[model samples]
Target: MVTFFEASLDKISVHHVGNQSQDELYALSEAPLELKDDVIPGLLMQYFLKPFEKSNEVYHLMHSSDDLALNEVHHFATMAFEDESKFHEASEQIAKHLYKVSTHPNIKGGELYVAYFNRVQIEGNPLDAIGIFKSENKETYLKVYPDKGGFVVDYEQEAININKLDKGVLIFNIEKENGYKVVVLDKTTGGQDAAVYWKDEFLQLKVRNDSFNRTNNTMGIYKNFVTQKLDDEFEMSKADKIDLLNRSMKYFKEKETFDLDEFAEEVISNPEAITSFKNFKNQYEEEFGYPIGDSFEISDNAVKKQARVYKSVLKLDKNFHIYIHGDNKLIEKGFDDDKSMNYYKVYFKEEA
Candidate 1:
């Protein structure tokens, strides 16, 4: 694995200020003595000489001692002093060479990926050059021209809406126009702060301090809905009330054949009977193809009997409204309180 220190040094040397110093300039009046401690020579050694010296194969390939190679290095240094424009161009060329050699297909077990420039806008003529190189693991290296404005990269292509430096993790959102995609990244421990690079601007997304807690709360509600359990203690932890309401509706639909008054009485009086009634209802449905009609009466012998009684039949109401004989208190509780005597109110259509 190439360490960060090696990568940083390579980046610096590529820009070609590896050995030049601001404090002193080499005097042209130097006598033709042994030039052992030359600054430019030291810089050349630091950038290129040392690497080739360590590897004899590379040294021979580059022909380091050749008169042509020495002239090329000297010519590059002279241009750096005489022409600022040529200096920048030479620096860029060196940087490109260094990058090409040092950046392998896989660095530190991660692939190197590049984002090519689809279009460019220059003052006079556009240089259709490719843009920055990025590691598959989110390491970034960019080359920019000082003369032209810097390049702009839109994360829209990556499906990322926002990028945030939260502590040491690169947090981002991968969202579309109205849909949400997931954001995932590796976490670093006690390292340099992570960088968040968006499309030349700060990303627009809120970073929550307790993102884990929020995520847990959301997942809890989802679990509750799946389990059909209501967690009323925590407000946000509760699933949609509609889920519970739907379960209640299903319960009523299955048990609707039972006399409501008897069910209310059994629920309040002998709650165990409610369990038996439920089991019986399940068995009855399994045996019989259709659900039994409402208004079956529980006889004195505990046998079920169909009632033939008729009253003023009402039209079908939107809400579930079943009439069962019960006292005022039971009626006041809307039959929720089970102090009611069981009676059946049957509705039969009159023959036309």
Candidate 2:
């Protein structure tokens, strides 16, 4: 969804943000960092842009109130976008907000880099972006220098690794009225409790209703319906459920677009089951407040990701696990009266 091959770091402001609960002080820089060296800017670009290369979900800034101006990150980023002179001032506000939200006991104080980027390609359009990054963890590096012929090893010092980006968000310059398009990465988010500061507290965001999210939501809701809800209203075997799952995935892989009616007829097949699925889907939207569209363009990336979590195995009383991929009818389950035991008969033409 995003590419940074042509991206460059134009300028950046550096600040030190600390954990608020620990009573640590946040230091603000008076001016933006000077990128005088030619190579330093390129290296900085790699550190900031590499992780976003394959980011699929796009987000937009959000606020609890009706007004978008109240959102701290959105306000500052918009100010900086409108006038480059306000960039440093906006960075200060961003850092201050981060410091205020860093209330978790395990949160670490780190250097905050607020940078202006150029030519970040997203969905094929090259747009300017604003990047807010934090470096939390540091590694000890051994320095070695040559005195004469042999190399002399020096002491170790803590330094941030260029390959690791702790927390970051890229806000594209497009869509000002609807809150800018945003993508975030938080590698150091310890747990669900500490994760809110980066995404929810500092930069309030909501998932965009694009193809990727739509596909993801559709797949998720269907999986829940099949695995959890379907058993309540209908009778099904484990093999039958696995076959249904496989068939749905096969349909997603073969088609470019998804239609509710088509999926219901082709995948669920039974009219009674289709009616139950439709009711469950409607209830899901009302319950979660996440609307799943009946028809949308399918995202291949979402399908690939969903495939990893789909269960396709049938566990039979810890004795044998039946792996069903296709044609569940080929496997038959029956009872034996002589030994009073359950048995399964499998059909095959060739053995692998």
Candidate 3:
């Protein structure tokens, strides 16, 4: 579990891989990211910082090497120190956005580096780009963000966007096979059109998939299954289904991670219901072609957002809540002839 924190940058630099248009390669000295009391910078950090601490995996455009993006960043940054003039203008653009993102009310400070490359080789061609990066570290910090009057604080972690960078790549310190988030922004004809790398990866692992997303999707499917069985098939009492849903939510709130088998054993403890769930899971995977993983990092935000789907209530003057989750057809809405009052006619096989 990663905590939220304010993001601060320790060093920043720019590199200009010279073209025939420019006489010599240039670079910017490593400097601090300092924008005191700026709104845009805070917002910029808030947005960019959200993806930090997600995964350490570095993502790249090239298929040949794992550290291709990492190497390019280092190469360009090193060159920037030689001659700073070539990259000064481009560095300003990168800085403008970084400051904008830092001003977001929720953004906490963290150490980050902004590397600008005037021109870097990509697929045997040179392209102008910016590299936003943060080195790997085990330190965690108290994250404080602006509020209505004051602010709030929490723990924080770090990560960066990789699968999609506008004509660029975001590199992380983590290394895994085909495990990176990559983005490619189109800058042809002087227009900035961004495209995510995972869109065309064609490989499952290469796609921009994460445990949080996977868990949300799986929970959505499970909700649908419950809906089908309860609303359409009438396979169980609505009360039971609602109870199960509530219990499942509690599990998600309490546990940091989810295991399919453990969920079956605890949440859906009945043997027959568990069997039904397993069968449905198999059909679900076959139809969707997306495996419901054995374990997942539970998303509390997603769980909170999905809670509305489980709402069931009978209202009376907005003062009383009568939970009627059983068969609605068994209770008929009507008016009592003598009392002239609204009432319900309930049908049952036996009267207690």
Q: Tens digits of per-residue lDDT for model 3 on 1-352? A: 1112423322244332211222332233344345565674545444433343342222333333545333333333334433555344435444333333332232223233464333233223333334454222234567799899999998755433333222233432223233333433222221122112112221112323456556666677677777676455445654456567766766777888989889888887877777777788778778866676778788666666567666555555666665654555676666788998776566789865
Clashing pairs in 2: none
Which has the higher TM-score value, candidate number 1 or candidate number 2? 2
For each candidate, what is the lDDT? 0.26, 0.91, 0.48
Off by over 4 Å in 3: 1-173, 176-179, 182-214, 235-237, 254-262, 295-352
Model 2 residue 92 lDDT score: 95
List TM-score per model, in order: 0.15, 0.92, 0.40
Query: Candidate 1: TM-score?
Result: 0.15
**Tens digits of lDDT, candidate 1, 281-329:** 4454456332433344222111111112111122234544443332212
Q: Tell me, by TM-score, which candidate is best.
A: 2
Give the lowest summed-lDDT range of ten residues in model 1: 54-63
Model 2 ranges off by over 4 Å: 315-321, 334-344
**Candidate 1 vs 2: which has more lDDT:** 2
Residue-level error in angstroms, candidate 1, position 66: 49
lDDT for model 1 comes to 0.26
Q: What is the number of backbone collisions in each predicted candidate, taken in the order shown?
A: 0, 0, 56
